[model samples]
Target: MSIEQRDQLVYVDNGAGDEPLSTREMNPLFSSVLEARLARRQVLKGSAGAAALGFFGLGLAGCNSDSDNDDAGDAPAADLLGFSAVAVSTADEIVVPEGYSYQVIIPWGTPILGSFPSFSVNNTGNDQAEQVGSHHDGMHFYPINDSSEDGLLVLNHEYVEPRLMHASAQGVSLSSGATPPLVGGLRPADEVRKEMNAHGVSVVRIVKGANNQWSVQPDSMNRRITALTPMEIHGPVRGSDFVKTLYSPNGTMTRGTLNNCGNGYTPWGTYMAAEENWAGYFTNKGDNPREHSRYGVPSGTGRWAWELADNGADEYIRFDASIKAADATGDYRNEPVCFGWMVEIDPFDPSSNPKKRTSMGRFGHEGVVFAPAEEGKPVVCYSGDDSRFEYIYKFVTAANYNAATANGSMLDEGILYVAKFNDDGTGEWMPLVYGENGLIEANGFTSQADVLVNTRLAADFMGATPMDRPEWGAVDPANGDVYFTLTNNTRRNDSNLNEANPRAANNHGHIIRWKEDGEQAATTFTWDIFLFAGDAGESGVENNKGSDPNGNDLTAENILSSPDGLWIDPDSRVWIQMDSGWDDPFGNCAMLVADPTTGDLKRFLVGPIDQEITGITMTPDQKTLFINVQHPGEGTSGDQFAGGSYSSTWPDNTPSTRPPRSATVVVWKNDGGVVGS
Candidate 1:
């Protein structure tokens, strides 16, 4: 497709644009299992149904409790969601519960490092490298000496919108997420650099002061790891021949991280940034290998056309992986293989190089959630591939986690497994090892490095159950139950329906929770549907899907769709954030709180027009909460943008002048109580 034609497809109803769908034809579908389970549910509705529900741990009351705790005869904890739920809104500002207030901090282009250059559309690429990046997604707050009032705030910058970011595109009539007109068939080098600088992670020191206000505090630890930052490659795929490129001939290093969507922190006090939707950053017109083809690398041009920079520098030209020589080392054919892995960064150590842990496997990694570490057990974590019909994954370290010596190296040697959900409310984790389960040399997987490089193909071959777009994952600290958000999937039809994913043409998504049979590293588990997202007006088996195991449905107090960002607090309250298109009965994307024990849910906060509510974290005391507002004026048309009109101008609220910016919002209660309460 021509560059102009591609630009026209950039802005969709959904802000981020749809992820490339999985094209594996032979993978097993979870729909049949779901159909069988639903049939069984219809036939057995009395005590037999109750017994079946208990077998799957589907009892709504106290289902998240441990088996030992259930037998202890302990009383249930008091309700934690005490605040009145907010109403749905389309206002160009934040709306929270009645007892709470919020402050906007560390917006895009806000300087947090050297020279402290102020924010401006005309800021140079160098200035962008020193300032906060754009479109904040997943985040984590690291406490300083375990203090609730002081800490390091680290977040991911998913991607950039050129029309809103560059001053040169002010009157160029560009839609949201569309690039400006090409200059002499090439993009301006500085514009490309600035966009690249805006697509990574940021670490800033924030302090809570009097009046419960939060502000950025410049410290030595404050840093910006952008697309131009240098990083190291570790694990089995480090020095493989598939990753040898002109930039890193030794295949042990790569430059920059892209499309950092979801994030996680390790037990050893380091941050991990997930590389999601990164395949579109490169164009591979020649020699399309399975690694690039399975990930949907464009054959014509990249999403942003960084490879067509006017200066034709090595860094920019390398984005076009058209083979230029006989071997991979002499060209950039292997450049696209370097991305799509979780990058580990130490927020406290400013000079440390971020390491990409290859043992975790590579795909459209929405995020990684690590289970609480045990003394003499392996460190276990779960991740979901955020693509239609993709599979969820788990990684168990080969070495047991030792608090005294735990570090990123533990991620270097691990077993990566894919999930398979069955019709009997049970699931298993199948190993994606190179030589196991038909992943041998005859089947095209030559080594462990090859399996890691083509993780999606390996998972498909293992007969893993395909799911809707799985986004964020959360683990309940009190009961060790794992929850995953299956964001909306409009492509699902009757042919692909399953027990876990029962809805066809699922516009609004659902959340699924599972409990491991024994430990976090165990392969077998029991699964159940926690909640289904929808509007109050929609009902029946196909539209909104049925309610949870407990009869919960759409109410004024609880309506949501596309559950993307998720977290479980110490009090066992499930926090859900939405990222969906504009729709009725649900005015805009929002955040909600749910009591898993009782299946009671309520809306907590609603965001501005055309914005996504994502990336949540909190202080050590749980009295303060932090969430992100991304792409506030996302769906504005080209004419609207050129006429100095936008859908939203949030955090600034100026009169049709300042473009809306993605920013972090800090929320606290008026009575100094817990945030949700």
Candidate 2:
């Protein structure tokens, strides 16, 4: 890209000139590393009776119905289907408890298209279509009815690494920093296209056989959707002025989905890929500073220098939000508004255009999760904002969830609400409806489209509670309680901490959960801290109950920090995943299994150095578990060539044969038995 344009590039950043465009601030550390453990660890130093343990009844541990054991400690863990908790491992490998076997099922650059060629160090623009995208995240398995060994695997590719990509046959790379280096005053059109094609979702058929072996059925129902794929806009905001782009003046359609992070599956058998951190991708050179700033779009340039492409077609110009047109219909100024919604995709039918469900309000959506479904009741979907001091939101579908009629239709129309946690242990789900709040034309909201498009503003105006950094959420299928990971907030000061978030300058994150008052669809609820993830020795700061309500202090054995990805297994086991910039006492980012009832937590698996273990999903039988390890070599500042020469070369096992590629690892029991049992 041109010097001026390259200066705005955030993706290839090696951290030299300007801070990456994602943050509203200019601090280089404001990225993921901004929320490091602060020096305020003295808060919980001394003195007190057991603080109000969440939900009370610590003795209920033994009676935890999820486990066959009636006793908490003395109870046979086998009844809980428990394996020996794996000790934290610092070795450069996947570490799981004994009797469990893990295999790398799919890695970045795995070919999935039958006609397309295999990945190479000399990859070209179109090669990504046949390859697995980088940074694999949230995923799920859809069983082919009556088949136990076959299913579909759907996942998201959040972003790309330029240094690792766009290299010649040699491992030498083109970029040195976080942003890609410019070539002849502009990013090569080929490189830009390849990266763009890498930022969507992938679906491939997977089959398991003897020895629990699994591989992708490349010629099967495999498909790839990238940043330029055609998609239709649906729900209340469809065809609204808010989404009027040059490509879709009618506002019913858009091109591509980017930053596909956490994902979900609708009862109707469709996939939901949530768009996150999308604002940094677009920039405005136009007069509409209001709309651009409202979405955190930088004024000068975008994170990617796609505008400087050799092929300056409409596709290239769309990345430049600078005003060049007379109105929104004349250009792509309104494109940013089209993203940040939960996109519904039909995995079974690749012919369908993924629809952006506008009813699910947008704003750095982490992911969406549904409550257990019933034949005739309003369906509820929960999501977190995934920004510091943002909000948690839910969509209460206007239509009841039904298997026969519910073919991804409930997500089309819903009442969107942001959560507000009261100090009294009660929380209210505030409605973000246009008429109910001050969301009227007088307040700049002319339509429901306005309320949904500018959802963050509406939530702020309606007095919704701002959380630390809501990431992923899960609803317990057994009792209907919802859980969310606050995921730490360095920006939070003492003033922001209320009963819900009780730490000043909160660094170590906490898990908060609640039960809806009457039914799964209730708007009001009772909430509490299920657990506080802290340092190895952090004391009774969590309502004085230590980390567990059973009055036990958190240790390296069962401790974790910066909780991110989360999911409740079929057996009512809460799986906690960690994400951080620094190595912790318990080693690198790892996964922990928790008994929600007894507050029993154990480390199940530990990832290699510098990789974040994310995106958890299990088979219908609950015997197989899947998780993603993203950016294995991310922690290093040098050497992107051969793996393990510098930073981390993880699951690749060997240093030279393969690059450290983000991939999905499948964990299952060695013998034919229930996993975790």
Candidate 3:
């Protein structure tokens, strides 16, 4: 595509122009960053003679800690960055340092397009194609250059869990207040359509105010890409016969992306969204030998038997694979081949058709982490397979890095490899290339298309090392070492443990790191377990590293469980997030800040009751922290939802009081001072 054409696709300038959706607006931090940058550029443009003077850069800003004004004795101040911790136990309040405060910028479903009316409780509408998706998940705030007054916030809506998202609240029979069984694995047709429309991502513009806050840009630059959105296929696998279905004959197009989890923004500035847990959305006959053998759908294991639903909508009925059609080439029994890959989105332009770059090698992609792209060097990425006993993967693009092409187009060509951890604390990057690694030569494999279609089998054939439920991964900008969270695996134990995964029944979970050999993407790397989290006292001295001097072991002070969200700040400070397992003794989920080099980890903030600390992002200044509180009180049902019966009364405890909604909160220190100092 030409640069102008690409720019139009990424910049999103037409359609509704600009207008704020709500009469009442709150200043958001996200928009402030953009405004500040814009003002700086405006000054330079308006006064070139004065602005052409020598540049004077500012020194490092630090997070300051609050100290008491005592004449006696006080502790020394720590040298943290421009960040502080503030506790927000409720939604109606934005608690921060004495000077800093936050406001609700975007909640669920405020109309993005003109067709959909404002969202209402239990309101059913067919204008889903033009609506903001339900349930916001992972997101990023991109300041358009360092000058534009506005920027885009690319957000992912992971999935729409029925009861919490739909009109009928998961199809419960109101008379008896009973939920129908989630059996035969079939969902109602309308429910399926709603879900399909709500599964993808949204790119909306945001602006800032002089007071340093952000707000959403109403109708301008607002676009929603749903499961029904027409998308193109790119890479070697595009146009392959395996992905063909009744919907797309050439296999060059597909509908909506599902289960988009954590994401990565290219150095060139576009968004890379990974599709996860999408396989279970399709249906196939449990008895068809040819179908079962071809895709390995495990007989009777189809989760969404949509073909059998009572609804006559073809979109809802497509998931079924049980019926035998005279022409195998025309029906959707083979639809499973189309999903589970990384989809790229350009936030600047809303009209661009998102592309699922197939050469990245599809699997249960939790997230894709890119190494800083360098000229003439391989563009590398690290990804995890989010299943128990699954493997970790890496992809090195074939193209040389060109700073000009950083605009999210570099992902088109790549050599995908799977990891194999050895018993000697070392690992190898086994190539899963079409004709190499015995993948094509192995049993039950026919062509390169087959290998990509069933990537798990290809990895298994290459002897890829199995890992404990690997979730999200982060590449250390300072050291190029990759860190991934192995959430927990009940089936693993001492006897079944191996070099890469050493623990069994790993309840508390651990973070694993590996360095590519000589910092080369194609070579193998050294590996080790960074830390083991568990109930400090019960976990034993061996896992704890050293005794706490007091001799007492199992203490809450030393305990942490199921480490989930993880981020490495610019300065290399590691922030760890924990998701309290269902059986966790910890009362709430929390985010911990730690110095891995020194093994000095401290609890920073805890989440509300019954929620997981998932999405976490910080500003370039590191002055504020934006965190997501997902699925609070998930166990409660609509029929039993009420004031006291509800699991959590977060953000809001009044109004209908049906249930708690997942929300994102910004926390910072008061006094306009740096936090953690």
Candidate 4:
């Protein structure tokens, strides 16, 4: 495919993007550091950022904290760069700001290596080894040197496009949203096989070509991890009966990592590919744990009825969570527990198997981000449980970080703490340890492993504040200030409104940020709303009534809704990406950038109809920026083959010819200058 042509790949994230329809603990610090720590705590606890601060009895000073503050995490003082902001548009093509430009680098089926199988217009499942995974989500670039020309572009394939995956469309069944039982039978085995290979993560070596263009090189380093690959079960929950199955009786190993969504990197140079909405992939008939049902695991046929395949092969049948044998060890009853984790992959070494770090506590992990790494201090990771009313968590390592000793071991011994935001604008991290809290033998906890296995249950017992759908998170590269995207929560109402989630029916979504009390590893912190999504005319409950930590409020010129993907670039600027159905009238989901120092926000790019602007990262030199366009026509209700009702035909902008595909987009400055310049 030419650089001008658009393309897409597929994966399994259970990604809700435009689909339609459908931690921590703290310890007592030594006296030497106590004064500074307390002082820092006071600044966060007492400082006022948003007008919401005064809603609490603890109260804010007459002046906003942004005006009186001495913190780098505060809102920007002014727009540092004078780049023009792109205007909102309903155009079916990608529209970028005037000075910025973009091209499609690796489309859905671009051949990676010469020897690998080529992508066919037939959309056949035969080229599994050679093609890229589907539905690209979170991504990051690992530079091989100081220059940004070459690096391993590691990205996540969040989910698959079943209708688009099969060589031929299932026009009748797909049009009305009928599947398996509803449509009379299971999908073709070939289709299932194609989807199985289209999930997990992809590590491709991309290099800048002679014409200032970039291309993916199918080197030995290029690899695609799918749903059936072998993986080790590591950390607190490893070797427990909760994970034992027919494949891994000892509870030490499992096969594959699917539905891998949000992406992250360790200071030690590794990749974290998280799994979200994995529970629904299985069909649990026998008496299952309550967590399964709470997570939306179906009782009969699942989203896809792979179990109905009559091949009598254990490999495909294992996806069924039902019991088949006499005992737990004899069947796959525990398979559901093996998923819903953040798997750590060593990208530099292709031979190494990825490990699921259970110590981080598994529960609908949207993304896991680390605080700025300090050689001797403990490393902290923040994550969000991405369901409505779910809670946020952070993990604190027991061992300090050292470049030499930092392997996956540090993540193996961390305490998972859930957040509880008080109306007073202060929040505490409640430890999710089994014995220490209400999780005990009488309540079904026998070891620490149980706590990790049932992390959601543990958080529920500890009274972690439920939040809007917390999706992606990023920490400022320069400081420990952290930010998270609370993607719209359709179910929120006045009955459940809280100080942190100020809105009743929060459809537009918002972003929340906090500065760690001392460092990333601190146990307690204060937080406030950074920006709320809606029209500038909005006021009261549905609007962001207050200003950012720097007291900067959002205006209608750049109003947004459903902020999903978020990133902090090397330049320390914040990039907010949007995801939602085409029905939303605010505008097509787009990507926006901001200078935290000046609180200047502007549209960088906008995507096609029924598509989400997600997965963002930048090259080392900050000249090249990468973004993903997912499920261009997710809300199409009927068959495109007959009525031609499919919502989009992207990358291949032709009308009524090619199927829509999810893809990665490369954005660069027209003058080869820094991205927002």
State TM-scores per candidate.
0.94, 0.89, 0.79, 0.87
Candidate 1, which segments miss by more than 4 Å at Cα? 1-18, 26-62, 66-76, 538-541, 545-549, 655-657
| lDDT (tens digit, per residue) of candidate 3 on 1-677 | 11112112111211110110111111111112223323432543421111111111110011111222355366543343233443323222333333455544455555566565665555443555456565555667676665333567677777654455455543352211122244454456665566567668877776656555666667556888887778888876787767676778778887778778777777777788878766555555544433234323334433333344555566655565554565435776556667778888887778799998887777777778888777878789888877667778888877778887655456767677888876545679987777775766547667666666667777877777778768778876766767788776655655556645555466556777666777558568767555566654433434322111111222454345667777777756677777653334454677766554434455566666556677666655555566666656544544554223555655566426344556666655455443333
Worst 10-residue lDDT window for candidate 4 reads: 1-10
For each candidate, what is the lDDT? 0.84, 0.74, 0.59, 0.72
The residue ranges of model 2 lying beyond 4 angstroms of the native Cα positions read 1-81, 168-177, 538-546, 549-551, 639-644, 653-657
Could you give candidate 2's per-residue lDDT for residues 1-677 as a string of tens digits? Answer: 11122134343333322212333331111222112222112222321111224233332222234443335665444444368888877777899998999888778888888566676656776898778888888998888894657788899998777666766323443332344556676777888888887789999889887788888886557999899899999888998888888999899999989888788878777889989878777777656544456556766556667777777778777888776778889988888888889999999898889988999987888889988888899888899988766789988998887777786667777799999887656789998998876788988787888889888888877777778778899988777878899877665554445556666556567888777887877888877677777655644343322264243567667767778899988777888898854454657888988886666788899988767898988778877888999878665555454333637777665655556788999999887666676
Off by over 4 Å in 3: 1-104, 125-131, 147-150, 170-188, 210-213, 286-311, 407-409, 538-558, 582-584, 637-639, 642-645, 655-658, 671-677
* Model 3 TM-score relative to the real fold: 0.79
Lowest summed lDDT window (length 10), candidate 2: 26-35
Candidate 1 lDDT, tens digit per residue, 1-677? 11122222232321235364244574646434454655545643411112234445444223644565656577775777899999998788899999899999999999999999998888988999999999999999999999999999999999988888788888777866578888898999999999999989999999999898888998999999998899999999999998899988999989999999889999999999999988888888987888888987778768788999999998999999999998988889998899999999999999999999999998999999999999989999999998878889999999998999999999999899999987667899999998888999999999999999999999988889889888999999887889999987777777787777767778778888888888899998878777778776554434653343344446777878778999999888899998877457688889999887666788999999888999999998999999999888877778988888887878788735568999999999999899886
Query: How are the candidates ranked when ordered by lDDT, highest leading?
Result: 1, 2, 4, 3
Best by lDDT: 1
Instruction: Give lDDT: candidate 2, residue 397.
Output: 90
Kindly indicate the candidate among 1 and 4 with the higher TM-score: 1
Q: After superposition, how far is residue 516 of candidate 4 from its true place, in Å?
A: 1.8
Sum up the clashes in candidate 1. 5
Question: 1 or 4, which is superior by lDDT?
Answer: 1
